[model samples]
Every structure is written in structure tokens, then in C-alpha cells.
Target chain A: MLSEFDLIKRYFTRERAGRASTVLGVGDDCALLAPTPGMQLAVSTDMLVEDRHFFAGADPRKLGHKCLAVNLSDLAAMGARPLAFTLALALPQADADWLAGFSEGLFALADEYGCELIGGDTTRGPLNICITVFGEIEPGHALRRDAARDGDDIWISGTLGDARLALAGYRNEAWLDAASHEQAGARMHTPTPRVALGRLLAEQKLARAALDISDGLIGDLSHILAASRVGATLDVDALPAGLALQREDQALRRRFTLAGGDDYELCFTAAPAQRAAIEDAGRASATPVTRVGRIEAAPGLRLVDAHGVPLALSLRGWDHFQQ
Target chain B: MLSEFDLIKRYFTRERAGRASTVLGVGDDCALLAPTPGMQLAVSTDMLVEDRHFFAGADPRKLGHKCLAVNLSDLAAMGARPLAFTLALALPQADADWLAGFSEGLFALADEYGCELIGGDTTRGPLNICITVFGEIEPGHALRRDAARDGDDIWISGTLGDARLALAGYRNEAWLDAASHEQAGARMHTPTPRVALGRLLAEQKLARAALDISDGLIGDLSHILAASRVGATLDVDALPAGLALQREDQALRRRFTLAGGDDYELCFTAAPAQRAAIEDAGRASATPVTRVGRIEAAPGLRLVDAHGVPLALSLRGWDHFQQ
Candidate 1:
């Protein structure tokens, strides 16, 4: 096999040097790029490990897509437009087929979002993928979680709980008879970052607080609440549980809906006066926006049933340090 | 043990939100930061894996410092001022003592540079560290390897060969006379990023082309040649071979000088007219800047003896994908 240097030269460095933005690229101590005038770069990183983040036999294409998508999700949360990303992939050995599939999936999503694969490092080790994505936003205009206030309406994009149900049993191959199941599987493998929606919100000045739902809806939404110094009462009935959750038992359904992660949906807040315009914007964009809760004067998260009664839960959601 | 969520809250988030250029930090889907006004952000990433990059039993403090330092070295290459960084750490399990030691070492260097730990992700896996550092530089003024002109003077900071020799088993742990070996070991473990010198060079507008020496002087210098579409001839007699190479055989010394990878010193090119000012700046800053060679009109790298004869090498330096 060719050594690492030769491999990078052959495969990764095959692209031509582009414009002035990249002053220097691959084969240096670091890649140097000139940021555009009046733009602030948004930076985020995520790490995925074999057997811990995904199964050993998981498809490389899915893995690659998810890695970039997760990082993009972070950019979206910050109201940043995707620009370029660097991948740091650690593997046991070079597997050509795996690399082909992985690159195809990664580039496909990157192309769709107009993100460039500017630089990366590939090394030999147990499989671990760390991706750091860079996006650009106008200076001082990125969305922040600390700006929300009491009496703001909490909104979520698309349905929840389906990703959790799929993770429980459906391995992206199995599907239930629902249009959203295909999307849920796709979300599990290759989440579509809410980039456009984020841009729309930023341009319209609608969202007071925003975050992408990577952890379960409640857990992730709680982050905004804590940061905003407010509380929320999520109306469980208003949640769009997708299709998979509809087939589960009551306890399982509630568990999946409340604590399942990997959704990649956007949970944001806006003032009540702006809700109509925000809903109209979502409709015009063909993106689903559901009002699931409201920010409250209190300072801790609470859940209310359709009848306005509290429900109990044994666990919150997936925690990374927990086994 | 606390679950991963609690662990992150306790250890990672407990620190006061760092203030370098952060607009919003932690607690959100992504941390948001704005580059300093009139400055562009310089970004770089690096990954370290168990056994491949460092021994499994290596000190956590040293390992953590090395990981962040390497990325900072990239920022140094671009003549950027260190501002913030994100760390992605994958581990088989949580070890409180290891985490504490690692954070101590990392925070020490970060505090010294005024670089803030802004955001990151941690997960379960074999020990792997990926750190992405961000810095600020004047727009369009960042140093790059592609700008070296044909007649530029080549310069390197500090001595070479020690890191390679230390890795090659030329060390005495107990002997007080072996201070150079101890220094080499320290260099291998906790390299100090040349951030201040980089900033100085940028502010003074001295360097024509610049990069950090991570993959040996020869290999890395070759990159400058390749990128700038020029060649170079090094005077072996004038090369700074460090104390570790002083007692070695000529062939072994040559090998050490040619292929040592962990030096983390700055290698740069400057116009002949700027040499006096460059030396003056280096002296003013107490940074040893030595003239090693000159960029040539030809398009291939060549190492010459005192008599200007080419030397052969079995291998250049460490390649990430090479075994």
C-alpha cells in the first residue's frame, strides 16, 4: 500500500487550487484561507466513534454524511451560511470501497449546501471521525440562545420521536407506511441541516432564540431555556411524533418522543406577535413549523399533557458520557 | 459516575464562559464567535490517536498540551493571533484524574496565549483528540507558503534534529548531563506554539512565506517549494542540528536533520532586502532566527553538502497514513 503522504497526494490533493480565499491548501502545516470582507466565520466540531456513535457495520456513506451534517447543524443554529469544512478521519486501514462511498455521500451533501471540502487529515487508527465545519455570517448578526424572553412561543421544525423509534429498531432499511419514515431514516443517516430556515429566520429577524435538536426535544430545548433564563411548558399533544411513534405503546411512545435524540430538527422561539409571520414563512418555504410550547416566567423545564396534567419519566435522553 | 451530560456540565461548562471574541459560548447547539473587527479568522485542525501519535501510557498533561499546541502552531504559521479553540476528545471511558491533568496542561498554555476554550464534543471510544484552533489576522495579510519568490532568503527558528533523535532512543533519563535529551523530550511532549513571534512578523510585514515545521524541515520545506513553484538549496554546514545530533555519526546526524517531525518551529522565507530587519526583530523578541538557505529558480528541493553535493535519504519524515 502507498504510504499516507502518497495516498493524500493521489486522492485528496487531486483538486486544483482555486481562488484567493484559499491562500494555501493541502500539503502544508495548515491550510490558510482568507475570510471574505465583512464576514465572521462560524466554527463547530463533532466527533463520531465506531460502536459508540454508530454500529461497526454501518455504511460509510451514511457515516460521512452524518458527520458533516451534524457540524452543519451547529452552523445552522448560529444562523451561519455553510462555506467550508475540514475532516479528520482516523481509520484502522485504507479501504478503497469504504472511502469511495464515504466521499460520495459527504460531497453530495456538501455540494447541496455549497460547502467546500477545503482540507482534512487522514490517519491510521481505530475508526474515529472528527469534522470541523466553518460557515460565514455577517458580523454581529448570528442567532443566539440567550436572547429569548418570557412569553415567547417555542416552535419546532418537522416531527419528533421518529428518529428515536428508528434508532430503537429500524436500521434505516426498515420502513413503516408513512411519508415521513423515509425522511426519518434519511435523518438518521444523513440529516438535512436547517440551513435555509436558519437564514430565513435570520433575515426576517423572527427567531429570538434557536438551537438544533440533536439531543431529545426536551433535553435540547432545555438548553435554550437555561441560556435564556426562562422556563418552558411543552404541550405534549402539540408534538408531531412522526409515524413510528404512533405505532409504539404509550410508555414507549412517550419515552421516544421525550428522550430520543438524532432528530436534527430546529427548535426555536419567537415572540407571540411574530408567530403568524414565522408560520407563514415556514409554509412558504415548504418546511413544517409546529408550535409545541411557550417560554414561561419560571426557570425550569416542565411538561404538560393535553389536559394540562404533568407526566413522569424515568430518564431524560441520550447522554454522551453515559454508557 | 455522572452520566456524560452531567460530566460535561460539571467539568467542561463549569468554567466561566471564556471571552476572547465569543459572541455566544457553550449552552447552544454551537458556540458563536465574531472575529475581531478588521480581522479575519485563521482556522486549523489536528488529530492525535492512541499508539499512532503517542504511546498509550504517555502523560495526559503532556498529551493534551501537545494536541492543542500543534493546532496553535498552524495559526502561528499564518501569522494569526490565537483567540479560541474547540476540542473533540474520544475516550474509551472517563478517568477523572486524566481529565483533570489534561485540562490543567491545556488551560495553562491557553491562559498564557489568551486563547479561550470555547466549545467541543466528547464521546466514548479509544483515546483520540481532535483540536481546532481559531485566530484573527488582518484581512488578506495572513502569511502563506505560496508567496515565496525565487530569491527569498530561507529562515528557521530554533534547532532541529533533537526531536527525531529523542524518538530514536538517544536519551538518558537520570543523567544531569543529558539536559538536551530532556529538552528534546519536553519538545516532543509539550511544544510551545510560536504565536507571539508570528504576530510580530505579521505586524512588521516581514515574512514572504511561512509555515510551522511539523513534518521535518526537509519535508515541510519541500512543501514551501512545491506551493511557491520554486526550489531551495540548504547549506548542511550552516543547518542548526541541535545538541542531540552533535555526538552522532555523520550519516545518523544527516538522518536526524532530514526527517525529524516534532520540532514545531517556524520555517519561513523573506526577501533578501528584509533580512536585516528580520534579524533585528528576532533579536528584539529574543527569538533565534537563523538563515538556513535561499529559494532557487529551479522547481525541485535539493540538500547540499558544504561542497554543494546532493545527499540521499531513505525516507523523508513521518507521514500520517504511512506505517
Candidate 2:
């Protein structure tokens, strides 16, 4: 078996491209980063455990990408620029093939976003990957959960529910054709971080409050409403479902689109006056933006149909420890 | 069973003392940190898995303290001031009593250092704690491993071998009296991070290179030598042992002190000319500093007795996956 130090050197350590802010990276007691002046660092951490977050035999390559991607998604929701991240991983064994594939996928996405892997710790245990990402944003410009205002239009970037749909297929709760399975599986494995869209929204002052929808749209949106002390009137039929999910029955689509987990899409609010600019931001980032609802001064969420009639639906987000 | 969100809110989130550096602490997509002007951010991460890092049914409080202490030890090695940290935790279940004890121990140390709990993730799985600490340091003043120079005197903070001695007792490899066991076990459970000593070393330019000893002195010292392209002549007999270990046989003391893991003490190198200044720094920080070796121009480690007689011994550091 390879020693811990050897494993880290062989798999995790890599040469940097001389990122100016990274004063010292791997092979030190700590990695030193010089944040740009006038910029506040946005930080987020997420932990993924085998069996709970992914299947036991999940692909190492995709797992690596998803772990880092989820953390980057948090930064995206904050409208922050990705800077660097640290990964703490635990493995049952030091398998060269698994490590090689994992590092390849990790660096591929990291390189694309110019996010350097600064430091990490690896140990022997049941598999777990915890990543903490750091991003840069100007002060007072962050799209905070408490910044939503009454009459603001609620918007969503990209589609939602495909990851949840794929998960249902895996759990045998739903049947899927080969093509549909592959397409939805890709959404679950490689959800894109809407960094460009989020940054555009914040920089252009088009979005007020924002968050990435990880645990279903309605549940995550409730966090924004609760924090901002506002309510929302959601147009349930207006939600942009995943391409595969769009083909499902109305009831299935409604459940998944409204309360699906692992969607990794941005749910944000903006003033109605910025509709044209928000549309322009969508086009500029090459991402689709959908108007799903409107924020209200009332302190409770209300659901409606396409014909403006109220809908009574009982749905909740994914909770890891919920019984 | 408590939901993940409820578990986090109930135990982790607390009212902040209005630390100026923390712009947004918790309850957001991401925590925001404003680093002081001209100060670089030093980051380090550590992951501790139950059964691997600690015994099963270990005290939650001690486990929490050790997890954070180990990460803080890295920051101390870099001569950085504690700023904040994010935790990613996995647990088998939501036990309120365990959560209370863990958070209490965690926050107690965090408050002592004025390190805020910026953010974290909670999930259901086998117990694992991963903490990434962020600290502030002036650029170019980080005590890097590569900064060691030839002819530098190597110094250590606090005592060593106690943690390993406790491990030996637990493993039934050594017999220790109840009093000795308690003393050594405390060292293992709640080892203090030498933050003050490290900061003094960096701020006053009292040390050339430094690293916290985690996997034995000889093994960790080798990292400094390899990075700095230097060798060292260590007076093995001069190593300071824990008070409990001091009562042991010389051979046992030497074995544990030279190759003990989990010491969490600082192993730093400095110019011999600054001996007086180094002593003053130790006094100021209230940490004992002992000179046990010197960096050499040659490229190999040499272990010597107090009389300068070279001693031959075969021992290696703890490797997590070593077979």
C-alpha cells in the first residue's frame, strides 16, 4: 500500500500556473492567498458522504467534479468570482486508478474556472469529500438572502429537477429509457456552476437576493423569503423544468420542478424594472433565465396555476436527516 | 429525527460578537470575510474520521477540540493570526447531547482565539469532521518549510511523545499508571495550538522556517530539510519528553519522542545568533522553547547523543495507509 505522503504527492500535488494571488500552495503547513484589495472573500463548504450523497460505486471522475462543482455553485449563488478551494478527502484505500481519474476530473473543472486547489488532507476511512471554496466579491454587492424586496420578480437560471429525476431512476422509483437516463444522469453528475450569470446579475445590479436551488426550488426559495421577511406568489406552471423532466406527466413534473433536490440552479429575485437588463444578462452569459414568480410583502408562500387559480400542493425539500 | 437545517441552526449558528472582519457569518449562500489591507490569508485544512483518528465512542467534546486544534496547529506553523473557519461534518444521527458537547468544546476554543465559525455543512453519515481554517499574515513573512537555512538552530515548542505514549497504553503495547495515563491522554485529546509563539516568531523575525510536528519529529523534520535543501544534526537525547513519559525508560522515551505522532508542537529553525531573541519570544508567549538540533549543509539526517556521538536507530513516522 502507498503511504499517505506518497499518495498525496502522486495524486493531489500539482504545479500551478503562477496565479498571482496564491503566494504559497501545496507542500506547506498552510497555503497563503493574497486577496485583492477592496474585495471581500466569499467562502462556502460542503461535505459529500458515500451512500448518503452518492451510490457506493459512483464514478470517481464524476464524483470529483460534483464535489467541487457543488461548492462553486454556492459561490455562484453569491455572485462571487471563483478564486481557490481546498479539498479534504477520506478513502478506504489508495487505489491508483481511482485517484488518477478523480484528480483528472477535479483539475479539469478547476482549470476551466481558474480556481486553484491550494491545500487538503487525505486519510484512510470510509469515503468522504469535503470542499471549501473561496471567492472574491465587492462589499455590499453580494446577492444576499435578506436583500429581496416586495414586488420583485423571482427568476431562475437554467433548468431544474433533472438531477432529482435521475435520482428517482436510480432508486427504481421511476422508469427511464436509455437516452433519458443518460441525459438526466449527466445533469446529476455535471451540473454547471452559473458563475457568469450570477456575476453579471450582481455587477449590473439586476438581482437583489439569490441562492442556488440545491434542495428543490420551493424549499430553497422559502429560505430567501424567510430571511427577507417577505412572501412569494409562485406561478407553478411557469417553472422551467429540465429537458427530460419536461416530457414527464404534469403531476411528476410539478413535483420534481417544485420540490426536487440537487438542481444546482440559481433562484433569484430582482426588481421588475430590471427585467430588460436581466434578460440581457441571460443572453450575455449564454444562460436561460425564467420568471417563475413574484415576491410579495405578505409573509407566506402562495402557489398558483397558469390560469391564476390557487393550487394546493404538499411538497417539501430533501432533508438528509428527515424521517 | 432533526432535519439537517434544524441541527445546524440549533447547535452551530450563534450570535456573532460583531467581528469587523466577518461581513456575513452564517445564514447565507456563503460567508463573507474582509481581510485586513496588506494582509495575506493563510488557509489550511484537516479531516478527522472516527475510529481512524479517534477511538469509537470517544468523548464528543474532546474529539471536537482535537479536530479544530489540529487545523489550528497548521495555522500556528505558518505564523498566522486566526480569522475564521468553516466546518463540514457528517454524523450517524442527530443526538442533541452529543451536538451540545461538541459545539461547546468547539466554540470554547474558537472564542479564545477570536476565530468565528463562519459557515459549515451538516449531514447524516459516519462521523467525520473536516475543518478549514483561514488566518491573516503579512505577505513574505509566512514561516514556510522551504525557508530553513544551513547553520540554523532547530527549536521545538512544548513537549512531545505523550500522545503516542497514550496510544501505546490504549493499544496495550505499554503499561502506564492511571495518573500517567490521564496526563498523557489529555495531551492527546486537547493539545494546545501554539498560535502565540508562532505569531511572535514571524512578527519578530525570530524563525527562518517552521512546521507543526504531527507525524513525529524525525519524519516531519525531514520535510523541512528536503524543502530547504539542507540536512540536520539532531541531539536525540536532548528532546524534551512529556512529564509522564519522563519517568519511563530512556529507550522507551527516546523511541516515543523521536517518532511519536500527534504531538501538535512546533518544530522551527532559526539562526543561532538570535538565541537571545528566541528566548525572549518564548517567554513572551509563555511557551517553552528547546534547542535540540542544528541545520547542516550536508544532505542527510544525523542523530547524536548529548556528547555528540552519532547514534544509529531505525524508525519511521506514522503513515495512515502504510502496510
Q: Please give the DockQ score of every candidate, comma-separated.
A: 0.62, 0.92
**TM-score to native of every candidate shown:** 0.92, 0.99
lDDT of 2 by residue, B30-126 (tens): 9999999899999999999988889988898988788889989999999999999998899999999999999989999999888999999989999
Worst 10 residues of 1 chain A by lDDT: A171-180
Residue-level lDDT for A207 in candidate 2? 98
Candidate 2 lDDT, A1-323, residue by residue in tens: 78899999998888776898898888899999988999999999999999888889888899889998999999999999999999899999999999998998898999989999999999999999999999999888899999999999999999988999999999898998888899899999988999999999987778999999999998899999999999999999999989889888999999999999898999999999999999999999999999999999999889999988999999998888994
Best by DockQ: 2
Docking class of 2: high
Q: Least lDDT summed over 10 consecutive residues: which range in candidate 1 chain B?
A: B168-177
Tens digits of per-residue lDDT, candidate 1, A210-256, equal: 88888788778777877788998888777877666776567666776
Summing lDDT over every window of 10 consecutive residues in candidate 2 chain B, give the lowest-scoring window: B314-323
Please report, in order, the local distance difference test score of every candidate based on alpha carbons: 0.78, 0.93
> Every prediction's TM-score for the first chain?
0.91, 0.99
| Candidate 2 chain A, poorest ten consecutive residues by summed lDDT | A12-21
Deviation of model 2 at B10, angstroms: 1.0
- Output candidate 2 Cα RMSD: 0.8
